[model samples]
Target: MRQTCVLLLFIVLTSCEYFNIKKTSPEAILKEELQTFNWNDVDEYPSFSECDSLTVKADKKVCFQQVLTTHISGFLQNEIIVVTKDISDTLVLNFQVSETGQLKLIDAKINALTKEEIPNIESLLYESLDSIPKIFPAIKRGQQVKTAFELPIIIKVN
Candidate 1:
């Protein structure tokens, strides 16, 4: 019981900081204005989905894996700037996008990555993700659309 209380306290404290940072309610992302098909009309966009249930650690891995195999190829097709070989790196970032659609990177940690690595990964990823269609079909009546949504994004070079 004491453990539960501790967990509850922890959640209360970090809820706004970790997850809700976006302030983008499930409805907003699903809305027609943002993606055309709210979570109700989800058509499976490969990456990104209603996967908040995942732990921060798991979410990080899922996002990285999804982007690499699913979206990296598309991004690489574009202009290649950095010639750096794949160097393993991990980052934990807190971000929020305003209603105006401005994406922001609040905080990030380069576990084992260098300063140059961060930007390279960021630039390449942002470019590649561009080809991705950001939209999800709205759900209705407790139905979870079995779509392969993008998890959190993480880049690693070995």
Candidate 2:
């Protein structure tokens, strides 16, 4: 009876380890869950209001980009700035689309020749983004997802 009880106890202990209920941290769990979707690729890109009616995916993509470019260009045109010296560089805009379809500007950087040339460039970029309408969030596997976008705008002062 003693031997039988010991065997039973061993079995119980081994079984518990076999069916180990691993306690995973919330961050670890989220990372594992997100692994199912490719972070670099989205099933559908975020769209602007003007792109809603486009049936073709390619057309929708182009339309969205065009509209975004137009809005940014218009905003830059409205901001009156005088360049004392000729400067040419690219301005990189980094932004994110929240899962709930909200546009958030992350960062804006200007490759300025001098600090005095565009001291308020970052704030100007933020104001320009603020003027934009709420963007539709990117879709991943038929579900809305938080996604990042990088837009490079060529700046030239002749």
Candidate 3:
């Protein structure tokens, strides 16, 4: 009888472990799903209306950037205030494209010195970005995804 009880306990303990091993807790499953997500890069960059014709990914990115730079530069040239001092600084524009393919300007920043000297830079950048039409969102794994970009514009004051 003692031997029978020992054998049954052993079977119960081993089977319990086996059953436990087969089942994943909700937390564990969530963690595993999250781990599979890639954050570094997307399969396709965001698309601009002007960039639709480009077949290559690199070309698309280049065309989109060129169009953006042109728009920003043109707007600045037309609307920017004339500063008396010779100024050279980099303006960083951080923006995002939503999954719904709408562009949102997150932030615009220049060097502290530039900010002090050129108060209009931020507003001009924001206004120019606002003028841009809807942009297609980035794609990853066959699904539209929100994507962010940091564009640095070199500004020189004459």
Candidate 4:
């Protein structure tokens, strides 16, 4: 009878999940999730009022870029830019949209020839960005996030 009781106790202890499975701590679980998460992607792209209606993420991004380019091009067209020689170059404008929807110009990469032709091109680009309408910041995991962009603008003047 004593041997039977000892055998029963052993079976019960071995079958219990507390003995067979290790408990996961909250910190360990969080760390594992963080390791698997992708940090470079955003749930939604930054947009203007006109782009807010789009449902697809890629469509929304394209619409945002189109609107921004139109606004900047329109602004630049209104200004008088005269060049002595034919000039064709691309200007890379690096800008950031803050979490609060504020636009800031980080850098303007203009070629030497373009800069020589237009002395105030940087300021012109900044002013054009400043004139853009209200922007909606990008979203990541249900939280608003800042995003940076590099837009290449072609400058062609004959």
Instruction: Point out the higher-scoring one by lDDT: 3 or 4.
Output: 4
Q: TM-scores for all candidates?
A: 0.32, 0.70, 0.74, 0.89
Shift of residue 113 alpha carbon in model 4, Å: 0.2
lDDT tens per residue, model 3, 9-60? 9999888756665667999998998899788788888888879988898888
Q: Supply the global lDDT for candidate 1.
A: 0.47
Q: What value does the lDDT take at residue 55 in candidate 3?
A: 83
Clash-forming residue pairs, model 2: none
The per-residue C-alpha lDDT of model 1 at residue 9 equals 97
Instruction: Report the C-alpha lDDT of model 4 over 7-95, residue by residue, as the tens digit.
Output: 99999988896667788999999999999988888999999999888999999989988888888888988999998888888888888
Which sequence of candidate numbers ranks them by TM-score, best first? 4, 3, 2, 1
lDDT value, candidate 2, whole model: 0.79
lDDT of each: 0.47, 0.79, 0.82, 0.89
Stretches off by above 4 angstroms in model 3 are: 1-34
Q: Candidates ranked by lDDT, best first?
A: 4, 3, 2, 1
Output the TM-score of candidate 2.
Answer: 0.70
lDDT of 1 by residue, 1-158 (tens): 99999999999988876664446777776674656535533222222444434446456445535544455544544454453667554445444333222334454455544556545655555555456544323233444334322234445444
Candidate 4's C-alpha runs over 4 A off are 1-9, 17-21
- How many clashing pairs per prediction, in order? 20, 0, 0, 0
Candidate closer to the true structure by lDDT (higher is better), 1 or 4: 4
> Using alpha carbons, what is the TM-score of model 1?
0.32
